[model samples]
Target: MVDWLTVLASGLLSFIVSIASFEVRLRREQSVEESAEVEDWYTETAAHAAEVRRTWQRLWDSPEHPGSNLTEISSQMGLFERQISRHASSGEQLDVDPDVVDALDALAEECRKPSEHSFHSNSNSEFVEFRNDILDAVERVEEHLAEN
Candidate 1:
């Protein structure tokens, strides 16, 4: 006589084991994908930071800045602000260091201030602070990328 109950129970146990195995594989694949995404984000964020720093340096170095309505400079600032903001927000979601995120915010805010014309001259104390802050933020981001 066939032991139907015993066969059914064995089949059920096998099915459960297969399900668990598939779940483990799926989780591992998800983890790998997440890690790759994080790495890509870091690389992109670092590149953006470097670009912002370069653009800001050009703005500060330009002697004709802040006096005339140079559309090109304004456009560059707008792009830099957008990039910084995007990276800053993404970094927050990725649980990047608070200090780094804060620096990013500060840089974006400073870049936005040209619209207000708050600091008319780069020779002023505020200009120095702003310049230093931008450089510092870029350095921090670059260092982080180097370490990873």
Candidate 2:
């Protein structure tokens, strides 16, 4: 009778340990998959932001005809703004750093302002300062995004 009881006890202990091990592995895999998904999202957002930054100054010179240049950059910037808005909302669930969202909002605000002569021969130092601020904000988003 004692031998049968010991066998039953050992079987139960082994089953519990196996289940605990499986649970740990399952949780770890879910974490890894979530991280990969987030990284893909970050890659897309970063690429779009970089493209906007690169083309920002070109809007003034981008027109063959008149008035088209004004619309071109504004349209692109609008798209960029919408992307940031969506990303910020999605990131809220992941507990993304607030700094990332704050910087994104700042970028969206700056972009929404009419492309006020992104650059011109007579543009003052203020233009340079504004451009630098935009760059810094973009970098800040990229930096904070990787932390999550």
On TM-score, the leading prediction is 1
Q: Which stretches of candidate 2 lie over 4 Å from their true place?
A: 61-68, 115-136, 139-148
Superposition error at 130 for model 1 (Å):
4.1
Give the per-residue lDDT digits (tens) of candidate 2, residues 47-87. 75676677655654345642235456656766777777777
lDDT of 1 by residue, 1-148 (tens): 9999999999999999999999999999988887887777777777777786776666666677642333444566667777788878887877456666676776677666543444355535555565576677677767656665
Q: In angstroms, give how far residue 105 of model 2 lies from its true place.
A: 2.2
Q: Alpha carbon lDDT of residue 77, candidate 1?
A: 61
Cα TM-score per model: 0.73, 0.67
Q: What lDDT is obtained when candidate 1 is compared to the true structure? A: 0.69
- Which residue pairs collide in model 2, if any? none
